[model samples]
Target chain A: MHTSKVLVHNRDRSEIESEENYLPLNVLRLSKRFGGIHALNEVTFNIEEKSIISLIGPNGAGKTTFINVVTGTYPPEAGMIYFQGQNITGLPAHKIASLGIGRTFQLQELFLSLTVLENAMVGCHTRGRAGMFAAGLRIHPAKADEKRLREEAMENLKMIGLEQRASDSISSLPLGERKLVGMARALGMRPKLLMLDEPVAGLAAHEIENLVRLIHSLIDRGLTLFIVEHNMPFVMSISERVIVLDEGFKIAEGPPDDVRANEKVIKAYLGE
Target chain B: MKNSEIDRTHIPFIIMIAVIILLPIIIPSAYIISVMVFVAVYGVLALGMGILIGHAGLFSLAHPVWFGLGAYISGILAARGWVSPGIGIIVSAFFVALISYIIGAPILRLRGYYLACATFALLLIAQIAGGQLTNITGGHEGLLGIPPLSLGGFVFQTDLHYYFLSWALCIGCFWFCSNLIHSRVGRAIRSFHDSEIASKSMGVNIPKYKLQLFILTSVMASLAGSIFCFYLCFTVPSFFGFHLLVELLMMIVIGGIGSIQGPLIGSFVILWLRELIHIYFGKIFPVMTGEVDSIFFGILIIIVLIFMPRGLAGWVEQSFNLGRRTYAYFKGPGA
Candidate 1:
């Protein structure tokens, strides 16, 4: 049986501990099995606030499974997930999201009928206080709340350089711009932890560059980023630490350079 | 789509409402006004079903059940002298909301065909009860003597009077539904229509939202039913079964499924078409009965699906946008 493997590169910055520096995401021995196959087995990691962490692996690696479990898309078969020190194991997707975990899909699951701004407004549902009665009747508080949400959604679109496209329907947007719209929608949630699954996949070089810049800007705005990407240069340049997985196991863990050079990770990606 | 004051988009809706208001006065015929009242009642049903089927991507055949139950509740209560027709309408809406909420919690979890089947079964069961529950419902003899709705010394006794009430109910439902679709709740419902996983990732409680929509639409149907009962002053056990459900579906589909305007338009067309069928086709096809009605609608739905897949509302939107485009083209860029 393949148990566990961890290669830690203890940076000097870990010594500078403070009350605000507590780990925002901590996954311990998380395991998810899809029938006879182990999508993720005993995967453990922690992410600090305001830093970018990349999860890289081969085609069958459990990066998406990890995200699905963390976001409560699927109940983990084993282990626990702690977000801001609260045990969020097996919570419903919406409950976990309300606790400040926002995610963008790899393939982009935008609301096709809504405009870009309206799509972002859907992301602000948890922050809304208006019920069906109030909204149906267009009462005062509901109107005020809706106005605030629209402004918030507009702000997010502006942050992602999509204010011009706010009125455009999402299905009409190009793939790269749609990816950015996905980011803008997620930003509407005001999440402390933002997870982006393959933000640069299928994007042109210029779009990738824009995304890289936007990714850094997100960290500056005080968000912790968890990215699953195949673009090595983008991941290596952006990630402070990179975790590698293969065959449902954590094969390598450290800075991007170390993982790039690791024998096991090289074998996992290239061949024996 | 912005709801700002003096929005240009609202002009058409305002004009449409104006037409509705002036319709009875302009026509001056008892028969036309009577048909308009039916259109208004069906308008409420279709609007409720429109939001569910078009925006939310849900299918349920139980709308007729909600409408029937509402008519029965208000009619039975008022007939028994237990309450006023006004209070009965209120109580009927409340109970429909509550009953649908509880039933929808489990039933709404079933998606697509399963949901349709479940709701259809519910309609059948309620229809059977209306026929079987003899002592209370008057059974096959039908429930009669349902008094008209009154408000503080004002009694609605005439077709013209009921026409206003019914149309007001329909327009009011449209106003609320329109506001809802453009609001946070509306977007939340539409979000799941395309991508459930994406909506869920954004912290949308899918089941909760679905159930809430189910409840709201059920209440709308109930109101339509309540109005129908009072307008007729009688309701048969066979009323509001599959035929009524198909009529509501036809209204939404013919008008357009997604836009509230589509169904509003659809309800009018359908009621008028039914009148035509009754006047002309009823004379020609003397052998026609319940079976012919189904075939008529089935073929009508197929024709609409083939030629006007988006329905009349969609066609209206397309031409509206096209007109705007042409105007802008002649006006030049950035005008």
Candidate 2:
């Protein structure tokens, strides 16, 4: 299997060019099982570097499970995951995050008790080096690092157009605004590869359009995006490439127009 | 984005500090001074616990073990003339911190009730060790003749001096704690309390932060214990036991769980309530019987938990806002 991949790479050198530049995330035969159910079965795909890719499928089609596996929330039963040419399979969530993979939750897990700014500031955890003792002493270096983090967090909020709400409590925000805050927080991590789980699931039409535009801006800044969405129109319009899953199997993968017209994708969604 | 340099929430804290400073002058009674000293000692202990329970969202029953270790180590060293009380306090705190880190590394892996049970087991182990290690601890008979803390030539011989010392220590810990919570590290710790998974995804090392908080609180508790030993000039296993743990826990919960002022205010309220109950009910109810005081304490806790779920700090903040509104109304809108 490995030799076949190598042979294909060599043959397609003219078209694909460098492997590292072409693929930021590559999964080989990734499988996950829960008891008797196969949540993901030998799924294989590679996400292009600096491109916005979408994973869309019906509920229970293992869309979220795939994201979970990629983000290191759940270890795959078999196969390897490579991010930026490094095997990151089974690494803990925080370790994966530090390696430049950031994600937002589908249910919007904003730090509700904290201000929006503080919520984003938490994403600066990996970047800041000051520990509890240094913070307690209010040392010169720690203070400087904190000021930098605050400024950076504010910048992220501004990018998300939530700078005005930086000091507002997260609990006071509407669901759509809170979702943006989650994205802003993830962006604060300085992730090269950002995975968004159901980014437009419960958003209003206007909010969905706003998120679509924001994602485009993010991609323009040289960040790779892996998005999971059930919103077909939003996914179709925003993504350059779309992958279709059906009951733990990838039924289709191509440009949005091709995937949308694929017989397998239509049958998988229509259940005939 | 109104950049008010100072947090308005600190107004109540300023008032509290002013009240504490004026307490000794207004009363000047030896008994009152001693009561205030007890409040300060427990305030320090509870503030440490607050960082764990309130900030880090961890509950440990083993704080008394660290507290007892502090008192016993200081007491033994002072009695044997091996070290000065001041050095003993610092040494004991480091020792307890080391033990807490070593034990906490593995035990903190268990979450919620399991973590609570593991720490409770540690408390029992410490109790057993205290009873068995008679050579140093003096066992149940207790270690006596522990010298009072002195600075160079001046010894803290009076309750007044000890009162000032304990409060000074409490205030210093409070300052350090407030600085910590407002800093970047404190924000990460608070993030853990809200959602561990979210915190982890944000690149916060969950286990490392938890263990750091556990060790820090343990060291703070140990320092309070050392001061407690010097203040009493003696130590016993019973001094650091389940009752003290319960009282300290009550202080943080009743004062406000996550707020800095919560533990301090909680400590003052609990101690004052216990004293008032002991004095007034001692004659009316059976003097030796524990039922009346226990019943009253239980009722008071129930009322506070039900009425002011966020504790006294939350209640005070609400009332402070109310007071502002009333003043604004009386001063005629524009004022």
Whole-model lDDT values for every prediction: 0.88, 0.86
Query: Residue B6, candidate 1: how far off, in angstroms?
Result: 4.2
iRMSD of all candidate structures: 0.8, 0.9
Q: For candidate 2, what is the lDDT? A: 0.86
Q: Can you give the lDDT of residue B42 in candidate 2? A: 90
RMSD of each: 3.8, 3.2
Instruction: Name the TM-score of chain A in model 2.
Output: 0.92
Residues A1-272, candidate 2: write the lDDT tens digits: 87986665445443334453546788877889989888888788889878999999888989889988988888898777888877788999889999999999988777767899999999877888898898887898688888899999999999999999989998899999999999999998899999999998889999998888899899889899999998889989989999988888888999999999999999888878
- lDDT by residue for model 1 over A37-121, one digit each (tens)? 9999989888998999999999989999889999999999877787886779899999999999999999988999889999989
Q: What's the C-alpha lDDT at position B55 in model 1?
A: 93
TM-score per model over all chains: 0.94, 0.93
* DockQ comparisons of all candidates to the true complex: 0.77, 0.75
